[model samples]
Target: MGSEQLFGSIPPNWEYKTLGKACAEGGGDIQTGPFGSQLHASDYVPVGIPSIMPQNIGDNRIIEDGIARVSLEDAQRLSRYRVRVGDIVYSRRGDVEKRALVRNHEDGWLCGTGCLRVRVGEKNVDSRYASYYLGHPNVREWIVRHAHGATMPNLNTSILAACPFLVPPLPEQRAIAHILGTLDDKIELNRKQNETLEAMARALFKAWFVDFEPVRAVGAQFIAPDIAPDSMDTRNPGAINRAPTHWPPHILDLFPDRLVDSELGEIPEGWEVVALGELVEAVKGRSYKSEELVESETALVTLKSFARGGGYRSDGLKPFAGTYKAEQVVHPGEVVIACTDVTQAAEVIGRPAIVRSSTRYRRLVASLDTLIVRPKDFRITKAFLYFLGGTEAFVSHTYAHTTGTTVLHLGRDAVPSFTFAKPPAQLVQKFDALAAPVLERIQATEQESETLAQLRDTLLPKLISGELRIKDAEAFLKGRGL
Candidate 1:
């Protein structure tokens, strides 16, 4: 397999072939299986046979999560349409670029109308190899160019059958699949680990803040007089004092005083109510001229870049033509609020980030969509403030005040006017100090996830194409012990 002797310089041993030639006798079959509307919402059971759809197909992978399910009776009726293990499913309707390699034998079930399953005949070519080839940049470009319909792009059976492929021998195909699979495996592992870490952090946040368990314990201890000081130990718990309410001999007395009001609701005594604008600097992102944008390695912060999860995406980011001023910069730690869309209102919106680094495109600067809060005279810690802003109450207020039909706009004037009960500075600082490490870990994990995604994106095009051979990739990984 001399690399120089290959077709298009793709390795001599590898032969250039069309997908139609490698498939079963009849041309690649493209047919819609069953309609989704036939399955009623009431009939949707939690755990059952999964109904594969275009949405299930990701970047050379199948997403089982959020998959629709159907009854066994429906599955029997569509038995002939069932996909087998090793079948490569291509999306025919929406998001035509998505494809998946059915690695697990269990996924051999009926797929939705939007997807067509490709079953290779008894040939030396590897299914995984075919999946990667079809998902490659060159093949994808051809598909995109040839796809018909302006409203929705599609790849019919004819187009797919005629699509060319760079066919490597069975051994080589297996080797290539193995090499690429290793990298993907590592990526998936990291993603899962991060998910677990995130879940742990969320659970801790819930226990400490949302449930107010710690505060409740503190409050309980403060009000209970019948419980001995040793029995009220913070570390190991003792029997709780069971004094009658009218008897007035419980820990409630020691708890901090609180006030209930119609306007601001219930709050700790001595806490002040103030508008969000009073506490932080609220600013909108800049709008750059169309021509000013360029593709570069720079990280551009945009509203679309922010995901529902508290992180920024680099995908589809464009560079700024001119140098951005410091004012236009979004420092690592500043809180960013999404002010434009009220529908997505304040979910991940109004969230703050402790900026760890600098970014570009200052002109298309951070938007007023985000209300940046820098601590002022108040005792509220930045971390605590972020958590508060993320609360349902704050989001509801933002949603209520949002104006405009097409694009829901939460104006600057409206933001600053929204108020919340502010706890004493000392208490706020204490909570912030306790919560800082947790928040920092969340930020770090997010950054790590971004880096991993970037690495995968960088390797995808080269690996998918014959430009980088599997042997070379394996050598690279072995050398790095990755």
Candidate 2:
């Protein structure tokens, strides 16, 4: 059914208006971003104002990962292209329906190349409401249907300006935005918190296993194995000593005191250089025909499932209609590594990602391009191994072993042969004990965010089309403790 049919009977006080009419009444305009002549490739610098390209535009948010930047001088010259808070930026070419609302922090960033900016007058229409309305399936369909170009769908100023818009009273618009924004705010908070939690876990792994900070403190002889270095007072002339204090004495006692020579380097005494195979085994996934990919409850975790640096993304899940071995099936919290990479930078290949639960799929299987890493011994936990896989040494090792031109492939023995300085069993367990809860918290927070996102998405179309009243939605949220 068309959007016109989706919004059948208009509610009382609701006004049907085109985007152009709404903008004209509010003194707003839909303008294309800076042209290629205005901003050249050479203008991009390592540090300066962020230039939000089409890729940066995500679902109602700007994805800052690998975003382009420009010099201050260039940004100043293209000041008119600068986005303001409450502005909506859309991709001008492919995926033209998707847009990102500019937040306070991104106010001055440029509406970069291959992009279009929709500035709505705050006094006439709530930009937040406009963003959510645009995200509605019906409205998105309209944009996609109207976008020109057979090869690549493109959105021009006139195309967007002439797009139909459903407008509510200014007060009603704000209320609807608030309800949806509340859920979005919580989701964003969880995302940020997860980033911090992962960073903390990675930092601890680097300190104990990679840097061997605890062993160094022991080697310095500044404090006894049974005592924390912080217990010593620098104020006392005789007690002045240099040692790390991050680890508690009980935890610190787990490390060996002296450095020993190894093929890899000088590692802590008693810590052995061990192959990854000693701790875990890598199981390759199933290869399916294109015809076997379909809309099903079972999803195939493909190369796209892994984020650029490292982490799982549910959006990469593809519904599958193929058969797979029991070993190919993966669950939430399981670790998986990409076996192939198509990126020029080799960003995905050899990188590890923890699989996340999917609301849409009941079962998940690893694709041929991925390998499920499972613990085969008690020496290492999944948490420890996941972090270990993220180490620079591990990534470089896999990268070096990859063979191919455009599509890099990791050798079958690449994972097993990769070596690392293995810490003691007790230390590994202790690290897991500390790190597991942090990861669990992150996962739980992510799951909650996913649920909130679903709720927000479900409420969006109904609220925007006047099929569901604001008061009723508020009541529903209140009942759910949202």
Candidate 3:
């Protein structure tokens, strides 16, 4: 059924028309990428014009990482399918509802084989509004329902042209777009800030634990076994030959003066190698039936909650059944370790995500396929444990012991036994004091973004359908001080 058929009543003073009519007055046309004969796999290059494929369409932006790019000449040969900065690209097949706006970075790139592009005139029809309209939940579902393909869903230009689109006046369109855009801009800002904060935390972790920079500052040096020192420093007790003999008292106080050999090479004298189990243990999650779950604020944190790096995925949250034990609850700042992963050849089976606070009223708990890793004692901070799970040794161990032919699984017992070097208590405390805030700031910003996203979702449909006027939406936002 068409969007018009899906709903009987239309908002007052608003008219429902096909997308073809609105796009007909635009400066840019709707089209799909070059077919098989026009492009080939061999044309792709490591560094050149990027080919925007189905995978590049993130929620509302272009995701180019790991995407294939082609040489400048190849891109020119297929220039007819080229996209501009304001074009809204969609997946032509597999997932017809997915869309992404081509920003400055994606300008002049080829819309790859599995995608479609729609561009509109900024004067007659606001391009941002057009893009936002197509991305709206109702429009996406309408497209999905109207799309053709028995085994695999597909979309063509004809079906797209007939999409039912609700349009307000050009000025009203811009106002509505502005209202939604403001919310998205704030969310994007928070997301970027969180990324920077997490990166800084990881860099600090590497400097303190892996590189031993603080210990090296206090006259301790590691001479590779094959190389000899230039001269002997007889005055300094801890310094090896040719090492710096003098150091400030404050720098000296931060690290151990002595070094000793261990399985992980020479660590500080008092530090000892301990099993992961001794410091932290995995508390397995509960299983929930499909029918028991409901869409609400409370979510069940599953393996999907794990982000690419060390934080939780905002979209990975799932609704809960409102029944769970206290032990199953995963609060903010706690770490969630993935116990299962893709059963393919490679192994990253045990990825970690530090739980984040979503809303003031919402609660999260671990579900099946996740293991809530709780520190045995307060000695190791949650932030420290999160990064520790991501280290080289820990990852290697996970890959070495993983079982199952297709659905690879990491044994819960192995988590506690995984061995790693434990830094001195004072150093750990200092590291926590430094790195914990970075992670917390990320959590705070992420929570704020979630609230902004909710507001956007609420205002978008009302604004688009003409149920809420521009002045009213503006007043609503103003009242909330958004």
Candidate 4:
């Protein structure tokens, strides 16, 4: 298809010009990030001003996870490379088509090496509109085709500047941005809310199971001098504590007042150390060849499905063409654990994630890199096991069982051999009563965000190219109460 037909019809009065002209007219500048020599690896600090590297650039948003940082002095030295609000940042080499718009929170972050910063000052163009336009499939394809290097596509300032840019009137530009930005804003709000909900669930799990806070509260009421409620710091394996909440008389009665010794450590009075295998069965997933991975409705939850820390990443799914047993098909809310990790730091091996429902796929199966860990014993819930897998102690145990030099692989005994103090069936039920709703809410919110993202992605290209007019798009959103 020709460029014009591929990109869609440019509406009347829309300015078709080079991106360089748009930047020049807007009093903006396109510049490269700091080079390696200018900012050395040794300059990075544990915590300071964030430096936006290529990896940090996501789908028009900067991913904060695993992002690098630099000291104030270093940031000051690289002030010119500091990104401003509404600026667009792109990866200079790999994934050259991806870009992230700098939001207010990311303002003043250094545009680190292997990145290009596009600053469109207030004048003839809207940076948000430009960002959405660049995300067009046609534009992305053009960038990939024009990028230098056969093995590793690379992008420079000139290459980006020479790209086509379609500029509507300033008011129209703002309107298009508002239409798309509203959907994105809601998705972002859902994401932040999910984080809060997850934190709440994790806190509850730690208090009940790991810290034994409820039992400690009971002991405190009885004035057991040996059991100090404040001594939670020493007893907790993670050594991190959320502020203890005042337990109701009924809730306090659920836990035993005294503590007793166990094989793992000093657990609550009635709790006993139990092997994970006794509570859950680890079912290995289907192993398939690369040729079997084709564009289809069937998706496999590969290692990428597990977030680096411990969470589900929908983008990690691979369309599968192979078949497997009916039992291998994992449904939403099921627990899956990564059995392999290619990261040099072993960040993902043994991590657990709950499967999420997909809008685009009909079925999801676990890949060989992951194992479906289902609760065999009714006393424990999937929510409990998921949090248990995320605990520092459990992760440490699994890490010890891992064997590999470059690519870590979880041992067959990694999940089954691991052990933890099992709470009473009553306590497990009580915990589930409190945690299940929160988890459900999280899943619902995530599903809503996924739908919103799909809607946004669908509307983006059409709106950018003027195939779908602004008023019609507004009407569609209004009809849905968006």
- Candidate 4 collision pairs: none
- In candidate 4 the C-alpha lDDT for residue 91 amounts to 96
What C-alpha root-mean-square deviation, in Å, does candidate 3 show against the real structure? 7.5
Candidate 3, backbone clash total: 1
TM-score of each: 0.71, 0.90, 0.83, 0.91
Off by over 4 Å in 3: 1-15, 34-46, 64-68, 92-95, 121-123, 148-153, 220-252, 257-261, 295-298, 322-325, 343-349, 360-362, 399-408, 411-414
Q: What is the lDDT of candidate 2?
A: 0.86
RMSD of 2: 5.4
Candidate 4 achieves a global lDDT of 0.85
Give all candidate RMSDs, comma-separated: 7.7, 5.4, 7.5, 5.0
How does each model score on lDDT? Answer: 0.59, 0.86, 0.74, 0.85
Candidate 2 per-residue lDDT over residues 50-128, each given as its tens digit: 9999878877999898888998899999999999999999999989989999999998999999999998876689999
Measured by lDDT, the strongest candidate is: 2
Residue 160 CA error for candidate 1 (Å)?
3.5
Comparing 2 and 3 on lDDT, the stronger one: 2
Top of the candidates by TM-score: 4
Residue by residue across 221-283, what tens digits does model 1's lDDT show? 433223232222222222223322221234223324434452676554455777767777665
